[model samples]
Each structure stands twice: as structure tokens, then as C-alpha cells.
Target: MDKAKVLETRRLLAFIAVFEEGSFTAAAARMGMAQPALSIAISKLEAQLGTPLLIREPRGVKATAAGLLLSQRAYEIIGLIESTVEEVATVEQHPTGEVAIGLPSSTAAVLAIPLVERLAKTYPGIRLRLVESFSGYLWDWLLNGHIDIAVVFNQASRPEIISTPFAWEKMHLIGKALPGEANAPIEAGQLTGLPMVMPSRKQSFRDTIEHHIQKQGGTLDVQIEIDAGHQLIKLICSGRFYSILSPGSVAHEISTGQLQARPLAQPLERAICLAQRRLRHQATAVRCVTDELLSEARALIVAGVWDARIEAPLCT
Candidate 1:
């Protein structure tokens, strides 16, 4: 870009913000800039271009035909600038800055610790923010830009969103084992007789488990509904009820004999995915965290720590 174009970049950015926000005052607030400064920049841009770019009104503002054209091109210009800055920052693409990851509470129980440990060792400069919530909330956060990456049981389809099939978190039937009855596989039909404490209908896992049970000519007789993952496990551990969950969720209890889990004879599994917005300028930190998640998941599968099939490699 020439010096004149470089000097006019700030005006284009202001105009872009104003055009998107539909009001000069709102755009100034978003940019943390003075309203008069943005107005001056937009005015200068219009003067140089010799066209009225915005139509100001009492309600707000609307983009003129010229303004709409500039807005479309400005997005491309800004995207390229951001990509260039990141490329010049690190030749080897060392990840820096913050990366946000959203996980379902149950999935986090098993995956979060190891993933965090690996990231801490591999990228000392990169920061990680972990958000645990239901899949629905996580999806909303991912779409709204509150989180950069998410591990969800269900994949989402949209123009702005993308998902990678990372692995499958195997769902197991959980109960307090009868004395001397080792953890072993159980026939799917037996699940219909067990009194169950389950995730609410809104939880995707519940849908997955129920669908599997129905396929087996049985139904989940959920006597109680618990929205929280840990509490659901605790309720099952109390010996009064049963619940189906990933073995990874109660790994410690299963290992130490406080609880027992059995895989269904007819297997049921939850698909685990890494989701992110399809950004024009992908961040190095996001890729670093994503790579670490896959690496840790693979190691866990190899070491028998997590009972999941490696469906896809990093970012696959």
C-alpha cells in the first residue's frame, strides 16, 4: 500500500465501524474513541472520495451506496492487515495472546487438566481461558465471539461456524456395583429396569443416551433429573440410582472402587468436536490450544486414561 492509502486507513476503519454500528456515537463507544474524532475522520474520507458515504438521521445512520461499497472492501483490507501483523510477529508461528476454550462440564472433568498442563509446557507465552457450560450455552458463546474454541457433543452447521471431529467420548452405564461384581459390559435391555438419574432434556447427552436406549428396545427410566454433571455422578454413586455417563467423568471413583461403570453391550457414544468461528485472520494461539487438545486426547487414548476413539487428528 502507498503512503497516502496508509494514512487513510484510520478513516476507513472509522467509517467501517460507523457503517456497521449504524450510528457515529455507538461506533465511537465501540472503538473507545471520541465521537467528534470519528466524525472528522469519516468527513475527511468522504471529501477525499468525493461522495457522501453515510446518511445521518435522527434515529441513527444508514450507509449510502458509496458507503456500502467501501464497507465491503474495508473488511478485506483490515483482514489482510491483521494477517500480515501476525505473520510478521513470529516467523515460526509461536502462539501468543489469549485463547478461549469452551467445554461441556462433563467433558471438562476428564479433558481440562491434561489439556491445560500440555499447553502450559508447550507455549509459556500463550494464555488459556477455559469456559465450562452446557453445549447450548457454549454454542451461543462460540457464535457470539465470547469463546474462540469449543468441545461440544453435537456439531453445529452455519456459514460463520466450523467444527472438527476430534474424538468420541464413549458413554457408559454407571451404577454402584454389586459386591464382587466387577465393572463389565451390560446388555442394553437391562437399562430399562434401572432407576436412573439423568441430565435434563435440554442436555444433548441426554438425547444421545435416550436415543441409544430406544434403539436397543429399551427406554431411559429417569426418575430424577440433574443438570449439573458432578451432581449427577454423585447421585449415581449414592447407591440409590443409576446414570449413563462417559467413564472419564467418574474415572477416579471407578478406579478407587467407590463407583462402577459398564459399557453397554450395544455401544453408545458422544461425538466430541472442536468448534470455532471461521475467521479471516486465524490466531496462532487458537491453533496452539487446538493442537494441544488433540495431542492430549491422543495420549490419553494411548495410555488408557480416556476411553475414546481417535476419530480425527489435529484440526481434522
Candidate 2:
């Protein structure tokens, strides 16, 4: 096969419609085209590839093995084209380009909405792409240029990355309140025997919690090491286990009495840092988002809702 040969977008779309609908007649109807025209398009595409892409059955059409491979590539190519067109059309007077940001799941719960709202109002032309994951993956994404910015935890300075201290967040022991239990702070030592569900070890937040637990001369009886944030919260809320998490992550549940959070008597705080690849060009759109992110985080801290202390101000 000639790798350099161009695959016409229209023909690819026609083939995809048939592949999904599984019948030329239905696909042509869905595409608002005649069945014969749709069949000709698919035939031309298969001829170009020099292989049979579809096998006609008594009931409908089924794709050959080669057809399956082309369908996957076709979707990707089409999606990229559509997104590129939309991005180009959005350019105007203000800074305009896609700015990809990475965030931990805990932080995303509190910050994603406000950040999107602020950018839409202040920099309407800027297209924001948010990626939610743990800090370790965020760091890797930043270095790999998969993301332009990331809100990470306790990151040290590296040659390829620049990190600025943004805030420090307090960790709390989250679980359902025991019968008639008071709302006082819980001792770190008490966690030694509790059934717990925690994030896996590679994550920075998990590492921070384990470090403090070991420091307090206690060990966590971890029942499950799950990375999915929502499910972990669910298990804790069901009164089956407890997990140490930042307040922002479980704020709604705590307010509704679905879960109760106790502050650690010996406080454990994690440094929240904003990081970027030092070598990546600081485009106007990216810089605008960076400033807005710092501003929004500062506001959250000052509002007294996020249970955090500002370590670096936006002006810095």
C-alpha cells in the first residue's frame, strides 16, 4: 500500500457511514444521499486501498478486517480536521489558541468550573482543554508537551520544568460519622487499624499521606488501592472504609451529611504548585490562562472555602 496516497475526506466519511449503519440503503438515507452514490464512494475507497473493505451479506453489509482498521483511522482524521477548523474560526481580537491544562481529580472538582467560567468571560477566544489526572501523570504530560499547564503537588524544580508554589492544602480523614461520635479532630495514631481505601502509591498526594502516617508511628490497613476518585468516595460514604483526602474533593458530600470529615490533630498539608515546561514557548493564550489560574486559586483560598493557604500570589 502507498502510505503517501491521499484518502479523500468525503470518501472516508461515506465509508464510515456505511460501516456504522451496516447497510448501504440505511447509510445513504442517514447521510441524505442516494444509495447508489454512497456505494460508488465506498467502492472507490476500497479500490484505492486495493482490498475488499466490505462483504455483502443477505441481511446487511459487514466490514472486512481491512475495513475495521480504516474505520479507526478515518474517525481520528475526521475529528482532527473538524477541531482544527473550529479553532481557526475562533480567532479574533483577544488572545486565541488551545491551552491544555492538567489537574488532579481532587483539585478539578473545585477548580475546573470556575476556571472555565473565567476564561469564557475574560478571554472568549481562548479555547481551554482540561485534563484531569494525578500529579505524576500531569508532570509527565507537561514534559511531553501533551499539556501546556498543570496544577500539581509538591513538585521540585527540574531542568525541563518550572514550578511555582501556589497554595498549601490541609488533609482530612473522611468517612461516615460513627454513632453519636463527636466532631472533634482525630488523632493520627488512631488510623493504624482503620479499614481504608486510598489512591495507589505513585501519586504525589498518596505519597504525602503515607509519609505523614508513617511519621506518626502508624500504618494504614489499606483494603483497596483504587485510582478512580468518585468510586473511592462512594466506598467511604457507604461506611465500609475511610480515606484521607483534601476537603475540596469531598466538600459536597460533607455538607449534605453523606460523609463526615475530621481534621488531623497533627495537620498534614500538601504543597499545591502550578507547573509548566520551561522550554515550551509561552504563547499569549497560555500566559493568559496561567495568570487566570493563579488568580482563581488565590480567590478560592481567600474565600475560606478551599481550606488552603496561599503560598505564592499571582503577582509573583
Q: Which number leads on TM-score?
A: 1
TM-score for every candidate vs. truth?
A: 0.71, 0.67
CA RMSD per model (angstroms): 6.4, 11.7
Please give, for residues 1-316, the per-residue lDDT of candidate 1 as tens digits.
Answer: 4545633668877887787578888899988999999999988888878889999999899988887777766756765666567768876857678888988877787788988888899998888899987777788787666888888876855434677777886678788863224656777677777899987877766787788789888887889997777788888889999888888878888888888887787876677878875553255667678778888888987898887888643352
Give the number of the best model, judged by lDDT: 2
Candidate 1, run of 10 with poorest lDDT? 177-186
Off by over 4 Å in 1: 1-81, 90-94, 178-181, 312-316
Please provide, for model 2 over 137-226, each residue's C-alpha lDDT reduced to its tens digit, 9 standing for 90 to 100: 888888665898999888986534678788988888888863224567777788888999998887866877887888888778999998
Q: Distance (Å) between predicted and true CA of 137, model 2? A: 1.5
Number of backbone-clashing residue pairs for each candidate, in the order shown: 0, 0
Q: State the weakest 10-residue window (summed lDDT) of model 2.
A: 277-286
